[model samples]
Target: MTDYEKFKIRHNVITLGKKEYDIAIDKFVRKALKNKDVVSIYKIGSIRYPGLSDIDLIVFLKDRPKHFSIKKFSIKNLSAKEKYMFMHEIFAVPDSMGGKIKLLYPIFSLEHLGGKKYDFIEPETSDFIPFFIQEYVKGYMSWPDRIIRKGIIDEREIIPQVYATKYSIGIYQKILGYSSKEFERKCRQYIKVAENLREDFYKTKKDERDKIIIDLIYLTKEINNAMFFDLKKYLDKNIKTKPRTITLYLGFRPNIVVFNKHIDYMEFLNIRFLPSNFSLICKKDLSGAFNDEKLEKAFEKRYKLIEQYDDFIYKNNLGRFMMLTNMKSQFNITSFIKKRVSKN
Candidate 1:
C-alpha cells in the first residue's frame, strides 16, 4: 500500500470510520483552495471520539490577503455553529509571510488536504512558549471547579468542554518531547480516566456525577503535573529575578522587572505590536512606576540581566528565547546571574 493509503487507514482506525468523513473533507479542501493565497490546508487534532470533537483545519497562506472567508463551504457533519466557529478560527490567524505558526499543540498531526505544498515554520520549542500554553490551559482545568462553584447540577452541558480540555492537555504534553516513557504513560492513563468519567457522567445520578467530575479534576491535575514536571524543574534551576509573577506577554523583553505596577511600560519604552514583531502591552490606565528616570534605569538594568540569561541558555544548549533581542549585543554580559525568580 502507498504511504498515503497507510496513513488514511490509520486515521480510519482512530476515527473508527474516516471513509464517511472523507468525501466532505475532500470537498472542503477543494473549496478552500479557491483562494489564490491559500498555500496549504492541514487537518489537525485527534478525532478519537466522534461527536465530542469537531474538525480543526489550519489554513496556511503565502501572505496577508485583502479578504478571507470560509462561510460558503458547507460540511453536513458539522453544525452551523461549528462551521461558524471554524470560520472565526481561520480568520483569527494573522497570516503573514513569516509570522509565528502557533498550533493548538506542538505535536499535532498535520494531514495535508489541498493547495500548493508549503513548509510550515513552527517556532523553536522553548520554555517561553510552552510555559505560556501551560498557563493558558490551566484556565480550562478550572471548568469543573467553576461548575461546582456555581452549583451547576446538569453536567450534560459542561462535560463536553471538560473532555475537550482533557484531550488538549494530552496533545500539548507531546511537545515536552517523548524522551520520558513514564510521562507518556501517565498522560495516557489520565486521559483514559477522563474518557471513562465522561462516559459514566450520563449514566450516573447527581451525587455520583459530582464524584466523577471531581475524579476528572484530579486526573487532569495529575496529567498536568506529569506533563510539566520537567519544565518546572528547568525553571526552578534557571529563572532568575523575582518578577511580580512569572506571567509572560508577547513583547516588552523576555524578562521585565516591574519597579511599579501602575506605569505603562509599553508607552515608556515606545513599543508597539507590529505585524512582523511581537507587540507591547497597552500603555494607558496602568499603575505603579511613578518616577520616569528610575523606571528607565530599571529597564536598562533589566536588559543587562536578559543578556546574562541569553549566555546561560546558549551555554546550556536550551535554544534562544523566541528569537528576541540581539544575541551579539555588546552590552557587557556575565555568566548566569542567579536570583530568586518566581516559578510558574
Candidate 2:
C-alpha cells in the first residue's frame, strides 16, 4: 500500500468510536488468527481500561518471518537495541520521557514468540530501583516540564499528561509486586486526581483553566519530589558508592546543587545511574536533607520485599554489552553503506 493511503487508514481507525473500534479490533483479531504462524493474540493497554484512544496488541508468532525484516521476530531472541528500536517504532511516546502516550493507528502491535503477554520477561527484583526511578522520578515528574519550567500550558495537553502519569504509576506498582488491593488503593488516588483535573480543565473558564492546571501540576510535583527524596535516601544506604554523595539538580540542563554549594562543573561522574538531571555530592552534605517519615517508611517496606529474592542481578553489564553490539550491527559504517547501495 502507498504510504499516504496507509496514513489515511490509520487516521480513520484512530477516530473510530466505541462501537467502530470494537469492530476494528474483532476484524484485526480475525486476520491475526488466520496466520498459521500466529499463536496467541492479546489485546492490551488503554483499550482494556475502556479507553478508545488506540489499540495495543501482543502478537506471538511461531518463528521469524522473512529475512532482516522488522515485521516478525521471537521476543526471546531480540537484542536490547532491537527491542528498544522496536518499541520506539511501534509506540507513540515523545522524546521527553514522561510525555503523553499516543499510539499510531490503525494498530500498534508487537510480534513475539516464547514471550509473556507483555512481550517481555518480568523485571528482576534488582530492577525495582531503576524501574521505580525511571517511571516515577523521570516519567511521572517530567510530565509538567512545559508548564512548570515555563508558563506555557496547552489546554489540549493537560488531560493526556495526567492520564499518562496515572497509568505510569499504576503500571510500576503492579510490576514491582504491589498487592492487587494496595495497587488499587495507591492508584485510585491518582485516578481521581486525573479525573478531577480533566473535568476541571474542560468545564472551567479559559481564564481559570491555567490556574487549575498549575495547581494540579504543583501538587503532583510535590508528591514526586517526596518519592524522589526517599528514593535517594534508599540509594545512599543500599547502593555502594565510592565517595558518599548525593547530587540535586535545578534546571533542565540542570545545574548541580550539593548541600548549599552550587557547583558549576558540567563534566562530572554521576554516582548513581540516575537521569542526567542529577549530580553527585558528599553524603555528609545531605545528612539531614530528607525527613519524610511516611515516604521513608513506605520506601523501606518496598525495599524489604525486593530483598526476599535470592538471585539478584544488580548491574546489568551483559545487557548493556548486548545493546551496544546490536546498535553497532545496525548502525555501523558497513551497514549504512549497504543500505545506501541497496537504495541506489
Candidate 3:
C-alpha cells in the first residue's frame, strides 16, 4: 500500500514506471490458493490501467459455494466504505502478463468459454464489439419496439446498459478483426436501430422524448471517447444522428408509472421506485455509465415467467440445491429452467 511498494512494476526493470502491485496481488492470491476450493483469482479494472488505493480481486472457486459472499457486510465493526464494499462484494481486477484476454484480466473459473462469462460484466473489462452487437440487438432493439408498440414510452427507461453501435463495430474490427459476415450483420443491425430511432422520434413530440434521445446521444459519445483512442475513425458514420431541429427545451422524464407495491403474494412488475443509480449492478461501478433499472426492466417481460420459475424453485428446493452445488450467485434459475424445458 505504500508508494514505492505499489509502483515498482518489476523486480529490477526501472523504466516500466510505477506498478508495485504484484506483491500485494500475490499475497491475496496465495491466501485464496491455500484454499482447495479456490481454482483461480483474477485481478481486473483500474489497477490494470493505473495503480490505485483499492485493488479488485475475482476469486473463482473450483466449485461454487452455496453461500458465496464475495465479501460480507459488517455494519457492526466496519467503516461506511468497508460496509459498502462488503455488501456489494466487489474488488479491483489485477493485470496479467499477456494473452488473448491479457487486457481482459478476468479470473476464469468457467474456463471452457475462455473468459466469456466475464463479458457479462458489461461496459467493463473490455469493449468486445461482437458481444455489444448481440446485446443491442437484444436490448436496444427491444426498447423502442416495446414502448412504441405498447404506447408505454415515458419517463421509465427500458434498458440500463447504453452503448452505441458504431463504437462496438469499431472495437470488433480492431481487436477481433472483421469478417465479411460480421461486418454485413453489424451494418444491418445498425440500420434497424436507426430505423427504430427515427420512427420513434417522429411519432412523439421532440420535447417529450428529449431525455431518451439525449440518452442515446450521450452514451454513444461517452463510450466511444472512453473506449476508442481513434474516436473519429471508429465513429458510426452509418448511423446518422438526426435529432429534430425543435428548440432545445427543458427535457422532462417519461410518465412515471409506479407499480402497485402492495403485492398479495405475487409481485406485479413495474419500475423499481428507488432513485436510479448509474452503476451497472448495485454499485459495481467498473461497468462505467450503465444503470441497473433498464437492464432489469429489459428482461421484466421475460420474468413474467418468474411465476412458473418461483414454483419451480420451491418445488425443487433450489435454495438448498444452490447451497449443495456451490452455485452461489452465478445461477439464473429462470433462464436455467427455460433452457431445460425447451431441451426436454
Q: What C-alpha RMSD separates each model from the true structure?
A: 15.4, 14.0, 19.1
Put down candidate 1 lDDT per residue, 235-261, tens digits, no spaces: 344433344422233222222211222
Q: Give one digit per residue, the lDDT tens place, for model 2 in 89-119.
A: 2211111211111111111233322223332
The most accurate candidate by TM-score is 1
Q: Determine which window of 10 residues in candidate 3 has minimal summed lDDT.
A: 277-286
| Rank ordering of all candidates by lDDT, starting from the highest | 1, 2, 3
Error of 1 at 196 (Å): 4.6
Question: What is the descending TM-score order?
Answer: 1, 2, 3
**Consecutive 10-residue window with the lowest summed lDDT within model 2:** 322-331
By TM-score, is 2 or 3 better?
Answer: 2
TM-score, structure 2 vs. true: 0.44
Clashes of each: 6, 3, 19
In order of appearance, the predictions have TM-scores of 0.48, 0.44, 0.28
TM-score of candidate 3 relative to the true fold:
0.28
Residue 98 Cα positional deviation in candidate 3, in Å, after optimal superposition: 18
Better of 1 and 2 by TM-score: 1
Candidate 1, residue 331: Cα displacement in angstroms equals 27
Distance (Å) between predicted and true CA of 266, model 3?
15
Choose the strongest candidate by lDDT. 1
